[model samples]
Target: MTADSLPPWLRQPLAELLRQRGHAWLLQGPSGLGQYELGLALAAAWLCEQPEEAKAQGACGHCPSCHAIQVRTHADLCVLMPEVAMQALGWPLDEKSQADIDDKKRKPSREIRVEAMRDAIGFAQRTSARGRGKAVLIYPAERMNNITANALLKTLEEPVGEVRFVLASEAAWQLLPTIRSRCLGFTLPWPDSGQAQDWLVGQGVPAADAPGLLRAAGGRPSDALRLASQGQSPKAWSLLPKAMSRGEVGALSEHAPAQAIGALQKLCHDLMAVDCGALPRFFEPADLPPAPPRAALARWSRSLASAAKTAEHPFNAGLMLEALVSEARTTLNSASRRP
Candidate 1:
């Protein structure tokens, strides 16, 4: 769907972006804040053959230009992303790369390859096929390694013809400062709680469950909707804090090792928040056993942060789960006791 068709929570950001002028822009924020959606909308609006007002808002979403983008056939737009991301977005790979991947010669890459950057450079120098110049959209732009990023640097330094660029990133700090310096930056805004809950209901989340789902996702509406749509039941999620407190490894059995660790990380994060006399972000405070001492929760936080680095490739998932839960039990038990 066109960006204009996204949830209403995103409309203000899209409009704010449209009002700005830039040859290149960096849209940076944590995930689920709609950087990718807003970036794509900006590109579509730039290339739209429609009237100026339409350009100043969002794509008409009905023009041939908008339809082309909808179907990924825009002649003057280039999408630079990791092969896996490209595939997921339905962007076609160059013919040779497609062949190699299809023939099992290689797997889709997780990082943007240098070859793809080279192709984009060539795309930049060409005359506009659609007479709207050209637009390059790089998503998770942090995926570009040094060589690929360096190649892109030359284009940003001296933008060719009418070419424009939008770089959307979840981790802006990981990019080269030179790259960051060449573009205007916009930080995505988090929607208000009422706005988030309303959007969640509009996305088909049960009205009664909206608050819990929203809280579980740390107030990111898109993430909350994603969890609801992905079948994360409220009851199952509500039970997590108490289960973890009891060392119930089975409480996390439904998640992959990495996902399980993320859940625990959130759990630890909320416990620390409670210890500081703040409300919990992920779980209902009453659902938690008790807040551990600040010192104990700090250690738990550090341990979980370290575990996150390699949680994806844990050598023994079962052992890791057991150890994690046992630690949880010790910490929670300590919290429940009087000095």
Candidate 2:
């Protein structure tokens, strides 16, 4: 879906700023959080030939170029995704042709590739298609390796025309410091869990259980809405509470890291709220698992938060899983012992 269609919380802040100030930008956010969609939206707004105010106000959504750009067919707007170079071999994917390339094993090309960057740079060097603005969008901008990144850097540092670069990335931290420093970025906040649950229900998640689905989806409305739309979320929701109470260390390690952490993150949120006496809850008070004995909850919360901070490390997965499970076991055991 296009970023324009996304809820306001999910829209990029820099897109709004660019409209106000007339500038280029970099967009960064978590994976599956729609950074690329935001980039495309920014490009469409930049390239529309209508009055600058109309173009900047919003993609007219009805303009011919807006329609084409929305669907990614605009001639002047360039989009560079990772290149799947099947032609280098004797095989390529086609609608009628079957190939042995394992789709599941496919990875984003290690880099956007120097050739694609060069072409985009060259396109930007030319005059605009409508004698106004030209736009180049690069996805996972951080994926541009040293050579490709350097080539793009030269153009960005000294562009020859009324060109704008809108780059998108899930891992902005991987970008060269120089490149990142030059670009303005918008940090999109994940929607709060209740808003996410409401969004899931709106997408046809059963009203009775959307909260659990929101928790399992990591409080990201887009994530929650997608699971509900596909009917895959209920099963995950069903598994989550049980996992919280009993899905020990070994089981957590075996399950998806994101799935396990998602549920645990919800539990942490719930516990924090309960400790602070927050009212108007998403979790049912009766169904709510009790927080750990006061001291243990504090200790476990610190450990889990620490693990969360280190979760990106290669070695942290096993340790984090064990820590979560141990914490869960402690909470459950303490609950049972209480009067």
Query: What's the lDDT for all of these models?
Result: 0.85, 0.64
lDDT of 1: 0.85
Best by lDDT: 1
CA lDDT, candidate 2, residue 174:
91
Q: Which candidate leads in TM-score?
A: 1
- lDDT (tens digit, per residue) of candidate 1 on 1-339: 355576676677777877878899999988777777888988998888888775666788888888899899998999999999899878999899999999999999889999999999999999999897799999989999999999999899898899999999989999999999999999988888998888788878999989988888888787787788767777888898888777788887767777787788888888888778899888887788778788888888888889888896799988888888888788777886635
State in Å the error of residue 290, model 1. 1.9
Off by over 4 Å in 1: 1-3, 316-319, 336-339
Off by over 4 Å in 2: 1-4, 10-15, 31-33, 83-111, 190-195, 229-231, 241-339
Q: Show pairs that collide, candidate 2.
A: none
Q: Please provide TM-scores, in order, for all candidate models, with all chains considered together.
A: 0.91, 0.63
Report the alpha-carbon TM-score of model 2 versus the true structure: 0.63
Q: How close to the true structure is residue 138 of candidate 2, measured as C-alpha lDDT?
A: 80
The residue-level lDDT of candidate 2 at 54 comes to: 52
